[model samples]
Target: MEGEEVGIRHQTDGGQKTTYGATGSRPSSGDERTAQIAGTSDSAPVAATDDGTSGLKSAQGVPAGPSTSYSDAVGLSSRRKKAIFLCLALNSTFVMICIAVLLPFFPQQAAKKDPSDSGDVQGASAIGFIFSITPLAQFFGALFVGRIIPKTGPKMVLMIGGVLVAGVISLFGFVNDIDDWADFLVICYALRFVQGIAGAMNITATFAVLVGLFPNNVSLVAGTIRAFNGVGFAAGPVMAGALYDAGGFTLPFLVHGGIMFAGTIWLFFTLPGDAEVGTGKKGNKMFKDSFTIPWSFVWCMTMFICGTTIGMLDPNLSPFLEDEFGLSATEIGLVYLVFAGTVAASAPVTGYLGDRYINPNKLQPPSMLVLCLGLVLLGPWAETNLTSKLWRSIISLVLVSIGFSSGITLATPGILNAMHKAGYEDTLELHSNLGGTVTALWAAGLTIGPTVGTTVVSAIGFPKTNAIFSIPVLCVATLGLAVGAAYALKDLYYRQRTGTYSLERQRLLPSKDQSTAM
Candidate 1:
């Protein structure tokens, strides 16, 4: 199926202002016109004259209008941004809840349906396949979906993906009803693949819309979405266990799927249409452009490493806990809750730092260092059989959770800012394509993590496997720090050689209008 991306933004050239994407642009007939887009509560439209200057006055004489092909209206209010944030947050929460609900029961579910008397290795492999397939499908979905978004629009893609996800997950509740083990495995794999595709489509569209609506708050919006996703992750397993105990496997799927379905329906009725941009020919070129962007590559690599670290635990953690501590499914779910809860609590704070206090580029290396440290600790922590493994596991999970959440929460905003600094136009198509690329790399990492983690653990055991995985994360962190230091030194050297800074130079530089209009 073809998936599309969409977003909304206003662009002005002199006195003429145009809103792009699903909201069609039109030239203003009057000398002054006010345009209002959805997701804002501002009653006063941001007024602009035909000469492309803001009507509002600044302290420093008439400040130069924001220099770009398009810029967010100075008058665009915060109320609208908050409204859009809530929608994205709820959507994120629902999506994660669906994913996490089944995690705690994977081993038991696989064994219950396996006809053959396979050993633990075989069971672990089976679990890996089950968990990894979704991300694998998502990888492909994200790679190709950007090409489709301009044609269909992001709203359609979001709604369609949401519906498909709900339907497929609901079907999961029926997997146990099948008689043959082969048939059951087939059904499970098929559902997961479809679910992954749906997830990719939904996420890509949602982010595209958010960027379109509120470009200034990219980090804040990203953080809020992740925060809710963490909340869903924290809540899903607990709710699943409770429901499973109350009814069976059927109840959890039905309940989770129903909640998602309801949210999807609400989004359909309430969410504003994303403004579609560019023809298919222009969009094709934009897709090509996405690959050419240098920061896109950096962001993708960062995503891949982060994803691998997070996903490494998926297949192995439950089985490892069960073997070492003899924990039940509920207990395993509770262990996961620690990680998810930490993420839920920390993401907004990390996001705020990225958006306001810290430069995202500067934040990345330290975040990765924390992740590496957590991974290193896992080996020794797991071997601490002398004390309660539970406490050790909790401590390890908390450390890892903070690192993982900080890394992910910072990534989108950092990359987006980098792209902006590099002189890329903040267009809907570009944002959508970049979003796809990031998601694709992340999915690829998630796919690799489990497949590799399971194989390594099966061969060498968890401690050695974990210690080995920490190497790549450490390598990535070191590279990021080196690059950041190089950039800082370059900037410093330029400042010392020149009497004035580069930013001051650019600001003092005369505009094209200064010569042409004169």
Candidate 2:
């Protein structure tokens, strides 16, 4: 009854009295009858014998299949994953806000650079130049970070970055004259570069770790991080403006540097060690050098156009708002808050929608369209006779936020996807270099955009300049989307038509385009 049935006639090693029995007990009349019934019936259940044979019957629970067990074990636990993502997002928010805090003060700082004098062209230019210089260092530092991360890992880099940045901030307090600026600038640039390196490592390494740690809801993690980034960019200005008003430029820098340094240290301690996380690989070459593109000139043009608009426009916008609207520091801060708010609020939803419901690549164009509208409103509407033009500018910037968020979410992922498809297995290095390339493009745009925006507006008038300058931005964003789409379409067409796509050859073309663009 309990297990297999054995016959009394079964032989043993030595002659002994033996009888038919079930596994648990001697066979009763009913048990014997059931065993007899099992033998006669073709469909009767059977149990395992002590000798591992199936004899008398009993049922066993079926074990789980491999796929079912695997799914259960690997799928991210939604609650735990969300918590980790939330914390990381919070960190991103803090970092972003810190970076942009100085932006709203640029005009005021320029104004103060020569309080006794008027027409502070040199002062404004110097500030703008100062802002631009950091990105250059940051650009190189980011690449260096990418190279060093696998060896030194993110933990050490972040710790070092924080300390250096704190020192730079403290040094700003002692700057007494223009001569002092040179040393300060060098320090600032160096610190910013290191900060950028740390930023790159922290973000990339964290994202990679999250993907493995969470598994099921990667978009949620990305959204949280990105949303925080937006929040920081938006809120930082207001906080900085308030601080500047109360404590002056010197105080804000000192406090900010100290606080940020503390944060960096906190992150160093609270975050896991490099051993707990995986580093994919590091490459010696710059990111852009790793890839080649077909139709090189076209894509190169597209990258420049895209970079110019995104990077250049924001830096100029702060100053333009000041000169054009006569907005105070608080008002300028509010503008950034709006810009950042729009980005932060939309990032998570957009990330989710892109990752889940919509085709990821397809999201790029619509977002660009929104960005174009934003730029158009900001630039062209400056001359509108209506009282609503100022409000319209605000509305337009909101759209820009949407577009910007979209571009960020799509562009980075899109490039990564492209590289992976093209068989660039060293994605970390590729991404790092790609970031620098984008940063350089952005920096160029930032440098040129302000000079051109101010000069062109001064010459052609604000409305005309806004409209004209916006054209390049619109062209670039649209062109980028188009080229990217074309790349995707070409791959599909070739694969379906000829059963394979020449990815390596196609990649080489973008490289050529880069050289042509340069």
Scored by lDDT, the top model is 1
In candidate 2, how many Å is residue 203 off? 5.2
lDDT of each: 0.68, 0.53
| Model 1 lDDT tens row, 1-518 | 01332222333322222234324343243311323222222322334433433332122223223322222422233675566567667877888788878865755877876666666566556655776789999999986676566556677888888898889989999888887877877888899999999889987877777776666567777777888878877777778888988998898898888988898888886665544354333445544544455444455567788898777787788888888789997788788877888888888888877765566777788887888777766645345453436676678778888888887777777666565555445555556676776778789989888777877898988766777887887877777787677666766878899855565234323346643653
Worst 10 residues of 1 by lDDT: 31-40
TM-score of 2: 0.67
The TM-scores of all predictions, comma-separated, are 0.80, 0.67
Which of the numbered candidates is closest to the native, going by highest TM-score?
A: 1
